[model samples]
Target: SDIVTSVLDVSQPCEVNIAIYDISGRCAMERELEIDCRGEVEIELDTGKLSCGVYEVKVLSNAGGDKSRFVVVR
Candidate 1:
């Protein structure tokens, strides 16, 4: 499974930091994504070796950031 989110109102092309953490606040995954400044952009998290459980997703950019939770079921 993958974690999907959107980054909107991007003013310029830049790199955004995407991180995923488990319920215990342990960092499970991380990635640096290069995105184009469109009206709205869809970002998908590469689950990789993540296990099935509840996790939090954080997307941070120079513009702003957001946090949310998702479940990865195998």
Candidate 2:
């Protein structure tokens, strides 16, 4: 199982894009959300279809973000 945690200090309403990619840089999953103002949110990832391996996570927003790597094991 995997989860995504996103924190934002938005000054106005906007959209955020989140993505997960395999080690080979293939997109595995992606989500776009609409949020307002400033807040923090957690998203549950359905990783049941994925095989055990390493992956990269990313967040795209006006407030800037970082990418992280993670591993899933069977």
Candidate 3:
């Protein structure tokens, strides 16, 4: 089982867009998240339903955006 964890640093409450893309650039999963002023918040993505392969995680917010790559193997 693989899980995607996103750690965010926020100064105010806001909505965030979290998405996962497969190697072919297809969206595999996505979630709209909410965060408080808490300096760091962690969001978990359940990848149990996805096939084993390379994937990309993207996070979008008013502050900025970030992207990361990951791999799953069973």
Per-residue lDDT of 7 in model 3 = 81
Between candidates 1 and 3, which one is better according to TM-score? 3
What is each predicted model's overall lDDT from 0 to 1? 0.79, 0.74, 0.87
Task: Name the lDDT of candidate 2.
Answer: 0.74
Point out where model 1 deviates above 4 Å. 1-9
Compared to the true structure, candidate 1 yields what TM-score? Answer: 0.79
Over 1-74, each residue of candidate 2 has an lDDT whose tens digit, in order, gives: 34544454555667888798999999998888887655555556677777789988897877776677778887
Model 2, residue 42: C-alpha shift (Å): 1.4
Q: lDDT, candidate 3, residue 63?
A: 81
lDDT of 3 by residue, 6-33 (tens): 7888777888999999999999998998
RMSD of each: 2.1, 2.3, 1.2
Top candidate (lDDT): 3
Error of 1 at 52 (Å): 1.1
lDDT of 1 by residue, 12-45 (tens): 8878898899999999988888886656777766
Which residue pairs collide, candidate 1? none
> What lDDT does candidate 1 reach at residue 51?
89
